[model samples]
Target: MKNDKADFIPIFDGHSLAGWHPVPRLPVSRAPGEPSPDPDDERYRRAMQTTGKWTVEHGAITGRQDPPGCGYGGYLLSDGVYGDFELLFEARPDWPADTGILVRASSLGSQGFQILLDHRRSGNIGGIYGNGIGGFHGINFTLDAKYDEHGRPIGLRLEDPAAAIEPMTPDKPALLDDAATGEQFLSRWKWDDWNEFRIRVEGASPRITVHINDGKISEIDTEALKHPLYNAAAVRDLLGPKGHIAFEIHDNDPGMGEARWGANAACRWRNIRIREL
Candidate 1:
């Protein structure tokens, strides 16, 4: 019942990690109180190769930066490569985390179309990012949640993070926008609760579509991308025709103010299933 349909294949077993392998995020090291080190240095490269921490908890596969809050993050890559498919999964990131699902990810260039679930200030979910392929963004909007006086998340808000803070409660449903608005997504996303993500990726220069909590957020055709940095042929060459699916525990960049991830926060996912198109 958790799958999209009987024909879809289950990717995660829920009780343990079986078909996935961890790959640490970029070797560029940046933890609080420590000066960044050279990524090409052999010691840093080897150390970061296994730095990420992943585990199973409460029927969900979870990822957290190792050593609780002070360590960097990584990704979980599927063992098999896929050409085109529809991926369905559920996720709940502890407040202020940055995470995503990768489609047809090329390990060589770190190239892929990422379905972002960056649940932090000025972040977004259900949007596509170019990753290392082109460093381009293909989203129309972002999200910023409400925080308590102590910086603990109290609720979600679709407005800019700089907007004046006023009284609001998560107890009420948002005034949902029409599907045509494309702005309907964040309002439909559950605050601090599990939300469903459905993604379809197809073609060489892939056409990607995303729906979160049953609200459509993005539909991008890479072959026709309008961004100045996007070069279709180059991206296609880097991605090839087939690649693996992946999940990310994003690297934290302190330059962007507070750490993008929460203290000891873990992003959780379960009921992963995929249907090849």
Candidate 2:
């Protein structure tokens, strides 16, 4: 007999789980001399005095940085993976930091898409990187001048690269002129302020929306990306039906802080909620 009640399980706030996993909290941290925990690891690193600098209060996770590299940072990884869903989270950086909300990421470190939270360059927020794609893939979308063996910038444009690689339709060859793009994308950013990020993934296409203090800033469509590394098939097999969510405490160039041996930078996250559609 078919049972309609079996299709729904009541949880909280008038919400029900219909083939969707209830959100689970998984704590994470980095401590001295301790190997970094794998994103898939079930163990949550307890907060320590020197290494684990994050604190959890009222269900909100906050990130703290000690001089150079006391500990890299901390993250709360989701227990399950997600495919097509809407993710909502609140973020307020401690003294202007760079963080990333990575999805569709593989345990093998191969595939995923990152919604960048950049305190450094606001316009550059939500740019995609890594795995054969150059720095800031979608944010700027500028084409690199074709280079010869000598590394000199040839006048050839991306249209030429598209022509060389036949049968593949390159989405609008990126303009090679740097001045044409302008810096307006970076100028309208807020530093040291809490911002809301919304990422919607539907199949191979992903859309990003950013709101600063409830005011709309930018919206980007990432469907036209042709990078083979970000192909749908590769991501689907690696991340399964759903993908894991992670907060990145990227260790970039020095002068930002002291470079401690074996220490990674950090970031914090709170009020993370997702609704599967």
Candidate 3:
């Protein structure tokens, strides 16, 4: 039942590079004695400086946000563009942090999908962010049965049927087909701690599966729909074969009430592998 076909391949298994090319970290405009930036930092600032990129430590890539107006506060990236591939990584937020994985990005802006990582009740985990209607791509089709001592679902939340019915694109709309519902079931079974995330893309559609503590949590089929944005066709044409992959370290203003940001966020990753299927 698992779709194994993908265009991109994995390069690492834990700390070892499985066989794929490892993206190099570019320098940014951070002050001296600051930490090194992640490989994805080259895209945001237009040019590489040493400010917001993170270094690989203790297994995961960490991200930091620059001050406001310093060219889009978070780390920018422009390396390792992929299409029709599978990506796997593990993210752990710092108590209350916000971050995401951006796919199909371009210099103009992010025109693809985002896999968000926020621990808020209102926001759905393993969902898409900032493509007009927020979190539309993140279809919460399932729920986990386990609950904490406080009776809350252990690392999982029930689907908001109202949100699921919202339209993704005006023309394309959103479809909660049987496959999507199945995906929700799996996602609800995930664990709370650091877990593995599997994202598979084929042509215009992508599938996501999460493994919490080495157990399958959820898997969603995203092949029937077109891209989330209206301009996706043109952007895809411009990208040609490969698309860019990036990590978002969003910023927040103290005055902005309860808006989420990537404050105190960090993660570790190993065994990153991809294959062109």
lDDT of 1 at 244: 82
How are the candidates ranked when ordered by lDDT, highest leading?
1, 3, 2
Residue 229 of model 2 has an lDDT of 37
On the 0 to 100 scale, the lDDT of residue 11 in model 1 is 90
For model 3, how does the per-residue alpha-carbon lDDT over 98-206 read when each residue is reduced to its tens digit? Answer: 4566665543223345666654433345554433212245444322233569965455555454543232332222332322343443544345456666765566545
In candidate 2, what are the lDDT values of residues 1-277, reduced to their tens digit? 1222233322112222122221112232221122444655523332222233445544445444443454333333455676777666667654235556666554422235666564332213544443212122444322223457996434323223343312212332231112112134324334444455555555644454443334443444445445433454443443566666655543323444422212333444554667666
Candidate 1 residue 238 Cα shift, in angstroms, is: 1.3
Instruction: Give me the displacement of residue 239 in model 1, in angstroms.
Output: 1.4
Q: Write down the TM-score of every candidate.
A: 0.83, 0.52, 0.57
Worst 10 residues of 1 by lDDT: 171-180
Model 2 deviation from native, Cα RMSD in Å = 13.5
- For model 1, what is the C-alpha lDDT against the true structure? 0.71
lDDT of each: 0.71, 0.41, 0.45
Model 1 TM-score relative to the real fold:
0.83
Query: What is the per-residue lDDT of model 1 for residues 1-277, given as tens digits with 9 covering 90 to 100?
Result: 2434677789989898898888766642121122456877865575465546889999998988776665466788888888888888899998778888888886621457788888776676776777765645655555677778997778776755355232122211121121223257746878888998888888988888888877777777778765555678876776788888888876666554234787677899988998999
